[model samples]
Target: MVVALARKKIYEEIADIILSEIKSGKLKPGDKLPAITKMAESYQVSQASIREALNSLKVLDVIHVKHGQGSFINEQMPLGFEQNFEIITKADIANLLDLRKIIEVGCVRAACEKAEAHHHERMAEALGKMWTAVENNELGEQADYDFHMAIAVSTGNPLLANLLEDVSETMIRTMKETRRIWLYETEKSIQKIYDEHKLIFEAIKNEDAEAAAKSMYDHLKGVEDVLLTNY
Candidate 1:
């Protein structure tokens, strides 16, 4: 059983407790997590807090949620997942977004040419999930990350896919942070971000490499601008 958490940073503390359980082998990979209500009771926090904790874990690729089912530990967790949660400075985030712009812009161009039907299906599925999350007032960070990863996979370049996977933990963290800024600190709506992603997906679907690259560059640059200005 998890211990009750203090009021301060309650959701983050709950996430850490769950992580400790996973690291201790008490919650093995593929194990189904307790129901949100059960977790809230165990942690002495609200169900909203429990959901937030699970969402953070999901963004980090430590867990995966099945709609209408429950969350589960990811079958393949990121390497050194526990160590990757170190504090990230704003400068670090800015630099990381810059690197993403360089990498993802090129990846989308290749995806426009190489993406197969199934790859497009995966991107569409991710976009659908993002829309659902947005409508439900959730961060939808995992779906956002999945959309980008689908683009990388669509590139048909294993090295590019693997490179993105290697840095995924940090990438998801920044995504969540940026989305939080957009949702809470600014006038931008999550719906607008979803629309930007749809524009990228449309370009890729149409097999327009130049358009896809430009869309991706514009999307990432927009994110970078908002992140740096607000965070």
Candidate 2:
């Protein structure tokens, strides 16, 4: 009984250790993790404990298991989560969007508090590019990404900025998909995207953290709705 309990506790600890390695970038997407037997030996734990840890990671989408081949880190995996755009299900997309919203809302709130005049200027410039893109019938994904990334940078938080950078592939992918849908399926979605970003910019310019966070949420909520419901 005591050994079983010890194994349980050690498995959880081992899982966290592996997760931390992935988050710290020691382990990367598509990187084949050590074999379970090796991991068990390295961690001084039983193979059962290592197996349990890897199983948990698989459940969280941190790793993919092949029957004969060793487990590999998921390419779509997020930093702590996973920002892979090549998702298999709508639920995966929803999970990514939810996490993106959490990070962005916090960044917007912080940007409102800390962003400088130049930061606001950069966002305005990005918005201008977005407008031009829409007028030209382009997706403007880069500009859209830059605008949000600028907001994260404006917060003066490297961690937040890195998080945004880490999930950029997901952001760009979602932007392209949503833009295409809005253009072909919905009307005035281009304008709506511009308007939403404008709201976020205005709130930041006015230094209203609460308002900025809300606008960001509303903007993202719209994207989530379109993708999940319409697309």
Candidate 3:
């Protein structure tokens, strides 16, 4: 009994360390975690101890298992139109979308409330880069990612920034869904986003806290409308 209790303590502590690293993006999605033996050695514990902790994470859906491939981080899940139509059950995707709506909106609002002019400038730059990438027909995905993440960083709240990491594949799913509409709209929705984001940036630049918050809220609401109506 004493040994069992000790092992549990060791496992939980090590688990916390690994989880924190992943949350900080030091261990990103699809990164293969160290083998059980390596982790055991790193933590100065028995292999059984590390395995037990990894097992717990697996149950929590924080990691994935493969028979011959070894353990790795689970990539974000897809809630995009493609996923809705062909990847998985719509019901599961619906629940996932609802969760993302709550989390990201809350984070963006918090970021808007706290960010500064320089942050807005940086965000604007990211948007410009995204547009350039789009015109080039290259993947503007990372630019889109950076703009939102810059806001999260500006929030002065690491939790808001870390939210994406903990959300697993939900982040990927959201981008996939949002981008699908953008890729095939009648009007240049890209320009529309460029304008909306410019307004958001200007609001932040001018220190219009209420306006910034409301603009972000409204923008996200529009995203929800698109996802619901189209997909």
Instruction: Give the TM-score comparing model 1 with the true structure, all chains together.
Output: 0.64
Q: Which candidate should be chosen as best, given TM-score against the real structure?
A: 1
Number of the top-ranking candidate, with lDDT as the measure: 1
**Candidate-wise lDDT, in order:** 0.84, 0.81, 0.63
- lDDT score, candidate 2: 0.81
What's the candidate order when arranged by decreasing TM-score? 1, 2, 3
lDDT, candidate 3, 81-147, per-residue tens? 1121212223444565576556655655665577777777778889898778667755465676677
In candidate 2, how many Å is residue 178 off?
0.7
lDDT of 1 by residue, 1-231 (tens): 999975647777788888889989999989999999998898788998787778667656688766678989989886677683543445666788888898999999899889999999999999999999899988888999999999999888898888889878788877876677677556778888899999999999999989888989999998888766654
What lDDT score goes with residue 172 in model 3?
Answer: 48
User: What is the Cα-based lDDT of residue 44 in candidate 2?
Assistant: 93
lDDT of 2 by residue, 1-231 (tens): 355443436767887888778878998889998888888889898998887677556545577666578889988864436332132235655887899889999999999889999999999999999999989988897899999999999999899989888878767767866776677556565878998999999999999989999999998998899867742
TM-score for each of the candidates:
0.64, 0.62, 0.52
Local lDDT at 159 for model 3: 78
Give me the runs in candidate 1 sitting further than 4 Å from their true place. 1-84
Candidate 3 segments whose C-alpha is farther than 4 A from its true place: 1-113, 116-118, 137-139, 185-188
Q: Model 1 residue 35 lDDT? A: 99
